[model samples]
Target: MPRPLDRCHQHLLAALVVRLPPSLAALFFAALFLAFPALASAHEVGLSRGDFVVEGASVNGEITFAQRELATFLPGLDRDRDDTLSEKELTDAHDRIERAVIDRIQVLGDGSACPGRLLFALPVEGDGVTLKATFSCSAPPGEVRFEVGLIEDLAFNHRQLLRVGGGPRVSEALLYRKRKTLTAPIAAAVVARPSAPAASASLPSAPTPAPEESAPSTALDLFLMGIEHILLGIDHLVFLFGLVLLGGRLRAILLVVTAFTVAHSITLALATLGIWTPSPRLIEPAIALSIAYVGVENLYIKDAEGRWRITLPFGLIHGFGFAGALQEIGLPRAEVPKALLCFNLGVEAGQLAVLAVWLPLLAFARRRGWLTPRVVRLTSVLIVLAGVAWFVERVFGA
Candidate 1:
């Protein structure tokens, strides 16, 4: 028969591997709330006359995805399984789903002008995992327009442009007339251009006009955006939680947080500044594995042994992940340093904030001897289990 200690370890591990106790759940939810930040309005929708610019006439619209449909697609993603989507899951799922959006958008006239053959792939605002494109006749300038809603069969409408996945669906199939635009002088001029006598039209004009270029995204915004991103990032928070669980004293927690802060900041700067770059596909799974590693280390090691050893090294990897958030926002060269500093600062602020709340509690627990060998062992085992769960999910999620 297994020894009592062995049985205890196994049982605790099992619990953590599957799910945490209700008590831990409260802490986890609290951490989730503080860590990931979001605004009621998450996505930006508008038009730009000058290559991704904010034209005089800009329209901001929001898209909502069906929570029930996404739950069916990625089961684990449904955090509550309540047939509803929470903010965090919606944010986490943004990248994968946003890729399917159709960028085949065309702007017909100049500033304050009508648009022609407009096509856009818009993300479902709440769902985070769904996308849809609206293909409609060009609207003249100064027309009030609404989010055309999800288009079910973009393939039939713009078969040439619809290359990948099917976009989101509208509740019902309805054909609404496109908005009519009050053409600008430039538009009227183009329209009046004698249609180049049918005979002269023989020489096909440039097959398709060059697409308007994507506008530049700022580094400051990107950096702050990174802060906003990490705050909303679930996997990243999971990794930080593992770190907090290990450091039981205020001093130790400070040392660990500092070491992590310094180390990750270096790497984040290097990667974001283009001094270095790593594939996210590789970094993401590895990040999940890193969480598992610490959890496993916590289970067996019992305490941090030395200064600037494990924490700093692991912190370096975490910094890379932080840099990835910067990458997602696309920082500009002129703003590289500022973006790097602010982003790293935001990351450190987050780590410091977590330490502030957790360290004191841990210290009190230790002083009271509540962090007994049994409890420490249990905490370690549970952490390892959570790490393992993340590892499996990330690996298989591919």
Candidate 2:
């Protein structure tokens, strides 16, 4: 064999040769998610959730939202104007906050008004606010009607995940401003579903819906959530684009994407199940770093020869990032496995959808002789810059 130094020199010289380019269309899609911070964890400010148990004539529920999100209703909630909420700040806005929250939510029992009381409005960890309320109905709990309308005050993409259970009826709804109601029938349920698996875990995780709106089952809800998440998670998309920038054989591309999928699926389960959860503060920056690193590597590597090796660890990091979002969506203890399974499936489906879009465009470019190393270099530079920017903002900014 040749001397070691000679082999090293040959390898270095080989890396200088030009490689084929990835589609520019993929880069355009990659840059889009960052432009819209409302979609991902820009400030973790876009989504809120509620959990309710309708038992007998009593319906107890708690709703949570980001502190910045609640600021839409009372601009002064954060008196210091910091993104965080202080205990005193919450105490001072007690009455107004309670009124604002409870007014937006209406709980009905068989078409009769169920007068409600705000039990407590307290600050939860992670710069969030939670308001607990109990409604006592004049009528029996035969018919439970719930309506949530926070979207009018919040961003249009802002979603409210509502999960309600009464007797044998358990329904979970992913709600938008347009879809702000959930109505379901139930026998008198004494035990709460969140705490107890009285409702079969075999049933779709927390099922419920708005009247005549054709609500998705919890599985479909999580699947759609996964797809929406990947589409909106610009950094993740950019990283995927970077991995394929060298424009290698189809087998090589599939291998790299498959490695990412398997690696992330493992961690998504671990973090979502409470096995281990690293902070988003750490995970977010790491995700950005992955994107930057991949872009840099693509500039030097002439082919996607060993990309699968690197994407494995980075995909693990990205899985934790995905978990942060799912937790915000709120998983019921009883339906944890179902939620986890459906969510992961949704994520895989989303990944497949993205690959589907990107590969076809690349194929067309190849056929037209439009793909070139120049396009790859330009796109890689942009990706590296974007990743570095996100890393800085996530690490230093709020």
Best by TM-score: 2
The CA root-mean-square deviation of candidate 2, after full C-alpha superposition on the true structure, stands at 10.6
Across 1-398, the per-residue lDDT of candidate 1 in tens digits comes to 11234888768756664686565555444443432222101111111101121122322112223343334434575666544565466556554334322222332323332232212222232222223222222332332222221233221221011111111111111111232121112121122111212122122221112223221223243334445555555656656666776564456656776787788788877877778767655665566677668767777654554534787887788677666533433333543565566556665665566657767887788788766665566555555555555555445543
Q: For model 1, what is the C-alpha lDDT against the true structure?
A: 0.44
Alpha carbon deviation, residue 57, candidate 2 (Å):
3.6
Among all candidates shown, the one with the greatest lDDT:
2
- Evaluated against the true structure, the overall lDDT of model 2 is 0.70
Model 2, span 1-398: residue lDDT tens: 11234877667634533332245545544554353333335324256778877766778777877666687558877888666777677767777876777777888888887877666566665446777677788745787888776567677667777777664546767777778888868675454333222222122222322323324575687677677777766778878878876778888898999899999888888877877888777898898888889989988998777779998999899988877645654455555677678767877888899889898887788678776777777778778877877887776665
Clashes of 2: 6
Where is the poorest 10-residue window by lDDT in model 1? 158-167
- lDDT to native, each model: 0.44, 0.70
Question: For every candidate structure, what is the RMSD over all alpha carbons to the true structure, in angstroms?
Answer: 13.5, 10.6
Q: Residue 251, candidate 2: how far off, in angstroms?
A: 1.7
Backbone clashes, each candidate: 4, 6
